[model samples]
Target: MQTPPSRAPNADQIDLRQVFGTLRRYAPWLLLTPALAAGGAYLLSRQQPPVYEASASVIAVDNDAQNSLINNTLVTAPPLPQGAVEQVMHSRSVLNSVVGRLQKTDLDPALVRGIARDLTEELADNAFTRFKVRARLDPQQRGVYELRARAETPQAAQRLAEAGVESLIAWDNNRAKQGVIRSRQSLQEQLADLTARIAATPPSSLERQSLIAARGQVLQNLSQMAVLETAASGTLVLVAEPVAPRAPVSPRPLRNAALAGLLALFLSAAGALLSDSLRRRVNGPEDLLPLGLPLLGQLPLLRRKNLGQGFVAASHSGPLYESVGFLRINVQSLLQEGKHRRLVVSSAYPGEGKSSVTAALAESLGASGLRVLVVDADLRRPTQLKVWSPDRLATHPLPGTDPALPPATTVSEMFLRPEAAHATRVSPHVDLLPAGTPARGGLPGILNQATFRALLDRWAQGYDYVLIDSPPMLSLPDTLAVAPSTDGVLLVVEGAKTRLADVERTLENARVANVRVLGIVVNKLARVGSAYYSYGYGSEQASPPANPNLRATRV
Candidate 1:
């Protein structure tokens, strides 16, 4: 029958309930990554160093000079005016001379050389890491050019700026002297040519006088030029001196710390997300697959030691018993359909808690005043009678000992024990059918064809639900022989522990045997305060921050 379609809720109209659902899904991830990033940023900010910067400037002037040695335009390039100051400030020639001066003056030669080399390297790196330097054109300032340097300490920064100024002056002085010598040599050559022209012939008085006066004027001009050169030579005026800086420019502690924290959080979040995505396995029933058919039941995880006792009635006060009762309720609810009044409990692999589920489920059903028959259909390992019977009959005599039975080692005789009571002695509401002693030959033909069918026919009307527990489908032919005769089969899945491929094969085997597969019962559902031996708190601990909106059934 078709149902009428309903109107969908608009996004803006969503209530707090829907918002909470979204939060629950992402809460675990939200808490993980940001924390990591913050920690990383904190460590980075704490480990950084503080820095200080100092600056000094110089001006290059080509003022009018009486002693113009070389044509100013020919000798000097357009003062990259800005670039030349910096080049002159830390020029190798200047630093080398300073190194030599420090040695001669008995100053710490090592210290001077070290400072020079260090400052040179520091300035070589771009401005962003060091100090910003600019050439401000100001006539009122000591020098029109500037040199700025930054270092680890205030003293170092100041010293660097001061040394750069001295070095630049020394370089300019040497350059000026070289210019003077070149000019002197050129003047001497021109004088010799004039002298030769005058001595080669009888020169008139006017011509001689004119030459002498011209020579004196030229000599006067040369002497004046020499005086100007001496005065103006090396001193680049100091416009501004080094003073304590107002703020330390380096190790922006707050900003650095913030950035470090952000980076740490980003990486941490990425890691957590990656791990969660890769690790999540379909572990629960609904998570495994949609419960399309009737959910025949689920069994709580059976502990290794619990295999010693079969009865897990609500009468037993321990948590083990409580969990068992819970399993019973779930099973009873699953059988509400009431199709064939009987169920075959089976697991894909051995030791998947099937036997315990069978016994507990039977106890649960029996408590409701409904007759529940528990049969041990596992021929290879008949555990029901051994677990349910105080006599320990299956272990002690092991069934095929009838003297009249005639050495029945095969499964048909061994699989049945006529001496056992139809009802369980320990559990009145539940009945047990032990796998009898080995009969003549083995299994497949004799046991499945005659012995099992007869037992089912005799017990058909005896109980409300005949819960036949069998061996794993892969373990033996016991389950196959019994599947066709049962109402439905309950496939048990161990969460996380059971692989998908194994479960698929188990389902395939049930289909091949023509069993009415009811549905799967996924066990070991995630729980709070539950611990396991193999998985530590890391693997087994339930991350409580799961979607608070969607919750699991408490029972």
Candidate 2:
């Protein structure tokens, strides 16, 4: 007996049965959305365009006089000259310039955003987040440097690769020349000043000496600048050119779409479970009421029943009529062989359709050809007489019920009225008893005597079946006092509104008085999934159902 969602702790741990049950319960539309989403994903996957990518390599070296190519120490060490080139290759300036060369148009914002996201993701994932520049391990190619990049289309892949290599080389050279140009031009101006000063003044004059000293200082600076420039220029070298890519690095259409679909599914699943906490929706039987008793029978909503030769009534055709009929038949059959000729039908409370059910039961039994006496024993208020009318009451019939049976009290003795009686004849084979005069001693006063016992015993003797209509058990002592006279009781419980505690109490009262409860009759039952009548339809139920067709068969 696993507790269902409404009482289960934490929606995340919903019972598997509950999840599936909810799905099945809401199968029409709730199940449709996920199916459509998955199908759409699969369809989109098939239509995806293909892409290819290719890669090219470039090598960089140290521009030092100590080595023509970048030495192992210089290349591997920090602050190497080619480190700047690596930086330039991965820079926004470099990547933007490369994209410009590709001439992309009609861009999708989503695709562009994803490309930018994945580019950073790939670079970081490949261990390139921090600025890293190192020389090759092989002695043969000691001066090489590597940079990685990706693009959506193959042509874009190729152009990006070529653009990165070209950008690195050009930026490196341009940076080197800017410093040399400034240094050499300044030196030339200084030398000219020196010459002018020497010519204008007497030889070895003060001005000329100062000009000459300045000129020497400018020339020394130029020499140092030139050395630095030359070293910087030689440091970078290309070992290979970028090739036209055979595949695209982006879009990963299959994987990305699958992830999107999976996320949708997971969120949908979690939401379906958690929605209950937010809404407090009822989702299962445990939420409505407890269940476990063997199902007696499910009665459908009846609109009408059979119209026979002065035998059937108008109430027989409706849903309640059919339900009650089937229920009465089931209850009568359940009695032990030759026992329970008398039965008390009542519910935990009023408005459970108990009044109408009593009428339907009488009609159903009489239609079955059983000589059933329908007794209205609710002396507080009578209903059976209205349904079964134009019949007169008679003296209590118990003491004369059967000579062989122990003598029971008579109605006259119970009510202390000589005129107290057992029943009335509503039809040729069926008898009816009104709740009788409500003024004839309040409910308990009528039930606390021989009249009640005599009515049950004599009715059982005169008819093949005896059905006593009583008030709500808890509402009055009517049902409790009358229940003991019958073989057993059928507690009619209305689903959804009826609580387990109330039902237990009803049985408890019957038990306290030593009444034998035959079985329970659950009414107002709907199909498990919905209000649809899916079960017991079209199939040949072994016995004829208490239906209008009355394809009669013994239960």
- Tell me how many residue pairs clash in candidate 1: 22
What is the TM-score of candidate 1?
Answer: 0.45
Instruction: Give the per-residue lDDT of model 1 (tens digit) for 262-301.
Output: 7755665556445544654334444444434444343445
Q: What TM-score, to 2 decimals, does candidate 2 have?
A: 0.41
lDDT of 1 at 5: 15
What would the per-residue lDDT of candidate 2 be over residues 1-555, giving only the tens digit for each residue? 111112324556755654664445444545455566666776676576655444455554444447744432222222234345555655666545544433353345454455555546545565442122344533433456764545556555455556556666666566556656676687778778777876787766787787777778877877766665564453355667656566554446566556756666666666665653354432333433443333333433223233231113434443444444556567666754674388887878876656556666676677678777676666665666555434243323432443343322322233444233444555545666555555555444666666658645644665777777778888887777777767767666664446566777777887798887765555544423322223443233322343342222111
Most TM-score-accurate candidate: 1
Model 1 per-residue lDDT at 156: 60
